[model samples]
Each structure stands twice: as C-alpha cells, then as structure tokens.
Target chain A: DAGITQSPRHKVTETGTPVTLRCHQTENHRYMYWYRQDPGHGLRLIHYSYGVKDTDKGEVSDGYSVSRSKTEDFLLTLESATSSQTSVYFCAIRATNTDTQYFGPGTRLTVL
Target chain B: QKEVEQDPGPLSVPEGAIVSLNCTYSNSAFQYFMWYRQYSRKGPELLMYTYSSGNKEDGRFTAQVDKSSKYISLFIRDSQPSDSATYLCAMTDNAGGTSYGKLTFGQGTILTVHP
Candidate 1:
C-alpha cells in the first residue's frame, strides 16, 4: 500500500502520441521506481528516482523517461506511444529504514 | 544470460498442498533476496524478504536463500486458494553505488490453488 497511487488507471492512445503517467506517494520515501509488466516478462524496471531531481535508467529504459520533481511525485512519460509500449505500469517506493519496496495499483495502457 | 532465472510455472495444486517456488541468479554480488506476490490485474506486494544466506518465516510462508548456490526458494505450507498468484523473485547487491536501489527480477511463476 505505502500510500501510493497512479493516475489514469486505464488508458488508450494512438501510436506516436505522447502519454504521461503520474505516480504520487504520501510516504515521503526517498526512492521511487517505475516498472512495466507483460506476459512472459514479469516486471521490468523502466526508470527510478533515488531522490528529488535524481533519476537513472533501468534495463528497459530505451523508450521511456521519468522525472521526480518532488519527493512525493514521480512521472513517467512516453515521448511517442507504440504498440510495444502497451502494458501494465506500476510504481513502487523503497522504504528508507528497510530494503522493502511497496507497490501501488497499476495503470493499464493500450496503444493502437 | 539473464541475471535471474525462474521457471514460469502455471502450477495448479489442490488446497492444503505444499507449494514450492524457486529462482536462481548468476550474480554472486546479489546479497539481498525477496519474493513478491501479485494477484491478477493488480500490483505486486512484498511477501518475503531475506538478506544474504538464511531462512525467514512468517505465518504460512517461508523464504529460503542459499547464497552459496545463488539460489532462493519460497515455500507455502497448507496452501489456500487465496494464495493463488504470481510469485516474483528479486535480488540486489549491497555494493551501494549507482546500483543502490536497483532490483533485478525473474520472469515470475504463476500458481493456482484450487479449493
């Protein structure tokens, strides 16, 4: 739970359109992560922010970008949507005191 | 080769049966291991976490880590239908640099406990 919420629980967009998904957290945790889940590929990290204005690319960050302007908000944006980018996106927060990471409800996005 | 490997099993079992899920990794630097349970169409939630090599137990779940073999396992005793979900194994190193908060996960295994 970790007081995390993602906007646009479901969305559909055409190819080549820009799309942004927002993740908000109330826990004030220092670390936030974005991941996409697809069949046969459990969960792949897209991007993550360790602190405000600090971010890094992940294993599958080629087509995605992220930003953490504030401790409570992390954003993931697709410059141009693609069919391959269609997947369930999840946001997670890492606890400051422990190694545990908690996840928020996912956003299901589909591109035509 | 992928850093972490797990058999993606759509394993179906009867209620009250013992269930075992496993994952293996090639990175010797991995010192922290964890298991997450994700219900259908929902986000994953942490089910178990262990550091280095050892076993940790909570209620009906047991997480075992064998660092020597770079392997980990999650066992569910007296499984219930509600336990049906996808299980994912994730690992990270304590090296603490740019890799600090990064987690490598397996493809995950699906389990279904029938009543």
Candidate 2:
C-alpha cells in the first residue's frame, strides 16, 4: 500500500550463482530497507539505503550487497547464492515525517 | 539472549475471544514501538504504534507499553477470523547515526481465530 513493489516475486537459483532482487517505490521515500524472513528466526535486516548512492549494512549483511543509484529503486544482490540464503525477502520504505515503515508484497527466493 | 523476545505462540481460539500478544525487550534505549500483522505469504503491515509508554486504542485493538518493565502488549477485543495472522513487535531507538531507522523485531506470534 506504500506504492512499493518487488520484482521477480519468486525466484529459483542454483547455489554459487549470483542473484539480484529489486525493490521499487513510487512515493519517493528517502529510507528503504531489505529484510529476510525465515521460519522460527523471524525477520532479519539485510541492508538498507538512506538516499541515492548511500547504503549501509544491517545485522545479516554478509553474502549480500545493495545499491541505490536512484531514489525510487534499490537493489539487493547475493554475490553467490547459498542454501542458507533461501528465504522470503521483504522491502520496506520508511516515512521520515511519520516515523513509520511500510512493506512491499515480498519476494520468495530459493537456492538449490 | 536476543534483543527482543516474543512467545511465538501458535495460539488458537474461538472467534470473539480476546487475544493478548506480548513482547519483551532487553534494550532500554528503544523508544518507538510498533505492531505488525502478517498473513501467510504476505508482507507485514503496520497495525499499531505507541511511543515510550502508556496505552493507545484503535478500534478493537489496544496497545500498551511499559517502558519501566521493558514489556509491550497488544489486546484484540472481539477477535475475528480475519485477525488470524502472525503478529510481530518492532522497536527502534532514535539515537541517530547507526541507530537511525533500524528496527529490531521480535520472533512473532502466530494466531488463529476459529469460527
């Protein structure tokens, strides 16, 4: 509902292959986040972008990289996919004025 | 221990029952609190937000925060089947720098309201 959409709603890739997931927002939010959800582990932050060309690592940033060249788009890439990386990825936009975050539909990724 | 801890209950109750979900945190610096409801295969959606302490009510949902106890609770009155979903508690410290917009989340509690 935040005008956020994730590309490749679902993906399947073999281990050791590089994969990139995309998050697009229409509201022009300044802060965006990527999180991975796994059974029993809950949601863990992967990476986030506060502005164009600005990014930061999160709790579980290893094996993953992010780029925000534009305000509306943020990309998360797995240098080499692994079985441990299989999970549902969610994108969120933080409302600077409201101090709230809204989430996208999410992308389900599987690494064989 | 994890920063935030939740019961992670796969709780099931009859429709119209009052449902209580809770979370506890170890970090006292967390000032902003929020609740998110997520359905199967869907992303989480914000349900309620309360800053610091005290109670805030929104329709049939009530959120209570006790900063001193480092505990937060969500109460749903007259719960409906539509409310059956995983509830996640999230908090953040606006201390700026690395703590800017990062949120720490609970393990989430699964609820099922049966008709």
Off by over 4 Å in 2: B95-99
Candidate 1, residue B48: the lDDT equals: 93
DockQ (0 to 1) for model 1? 0.61
- After the best TM-score superposition of candidate 1, give how far the Cα of residue B64 lies from its true spot, in angstroms: 0.7
Interface root mean square deviation per prediction: 2.2, 2.4
Model 1 chain B TM at 0.95
Best by TM-score: 2
* Lowest lDDT block of 10, candidate 1 chain B: B93-102
Give the Å error, residue A48, model 2. 0.7
lDDT of 1 by residue, B1-115 (tens): 8899999988999999999999999999899888999999889999999989999999999999998999999999999999999999998885334444778899999999999
Candidate 2 lDDT, B30-89, residue by residue in tens:
888999999999999999998899999999999999999999999999999999999999
* Candidate 2 clashing pairs, residues 3+ apart or interchain: none
The whole-model C-alpha lDDT of candidate 2 against the native structure comes to: 0.94
